[model samples]
Target: MDSTKEKIFRCAIDLFNDKGVSHVTLRDIAEKVGISIGNLAYHFKNKDYIIAEAFGRMEEEKMNILSGVQQIPSFENINNQVEPLLNISKKYRFFFLDTVQILKSYPAIKHKHQAYVENSIRYVKAVLDYSVGSGNMSPEPEDDKGLYWRVATTAWMHLYFWPAEVAIRGKSDPDIGEVKKMMWGVIKPYLTEKGIHNFETIKKEMYASA
Candidate 1:
């Protein structure tokens, strides 16, 4: 059973996803959750407070998923990590779909989100680093460390915003698997011959399964 706070958290996401963050009020959340405004205020008095809690849940889950992958990652391990976080993103679509204000309005959430972005970049680069060391990926040009981060950031951008991008495009939301393909494709250019074979084989499987 969801506690009152948990109930409010979900109700808040539903309202924010529908009416948007800017338009929702405390009373609206209380009404939806079948709680009085005074009762809801005990948990969260404002949108920023509620959203920070929700964002905390989302990031905690994402970090927990990333933590399971270990510091070293193979091509397939990297693909596996994306699905978990992407599902979390879909659940809290408003966070990505209508992000600017909520982040701006809540500096702590904004800062933590920035840290998550950095952590994701580090994770991807670590995978590439391991792949390069093991001869599964091409070496960075002149051993330039910046190159890895650039590639990682490109991949992260797609994972972070594919849903929001689709929303802006007025297109159907791509499935989590499709988003993974788009994400993997960003770094596909950096893979070695063996890595390419694995990438292609798995890509087809994901496409087929989806």
Candidate 2:
């Protein structure tokens, strides 16, 4: 939380986004922060330690974003959820892409990656539970089908990562509106009749606001 520590984390995140994690070293972060490696070490013990801290910071930011949505009164409104996710994609586009790329190299960070996946699943499950409880969904209590839908929806949202990385490579930026439409198609069949109506109403409100 110290200003210097925050600077180091931001510098490390930028470097990791520009260069793959495997290619980044503590020296790179230290140089970026304009601090000595020894000084950096005074805050973080090693490269892995710094990487873990960076990931923790990312998780914290994500939780904060989710918390903002959780405070919204209407869980049945898809826009209330989707909008924050789009905001997250826009703000942390590079971070998410870099994290996915790092995850592909599972052999190097197997345990860390597994922990991240498990934590992500738990976070998503909590959101799904909230949605169901708040009348956004009609899933049977703790049913496997309900669980599957939640997990699948989470994966569907992750599709944004592909377009985000592509845009980084000079391809077209992702259209968040189109992404919402596609996601709605995938989510519609799972919703109850009331849920469907609520979804449509939310969609109309979203468009009207736009």
**Best by the TM-score measure:** 1
Candidate 1 per-residue lDDT over residues 18-45, each given as its tens digit: 8888898998999999999999989987
In model 2, where do residues sit more than 4 Å from their true spots? Answer: 64-73, 76-78, 86-95, 98-115, 122-173, 205-210
Worst 10 residues of 2 by lDDT: 69-78
Model 1 misses residue 8 by how many Å?
1.1
Pairs in clash, predicted candidate 1: none
Clashes of 1: 0
Tell me how far the alpha carbon of residue 147 in candidate 1 is from the true structure, in angstroms, after superposition: 1.4
TM-score of 2: 0.68
lDDT of 2 by residue, 16-35 (tens): 76775778899999998999
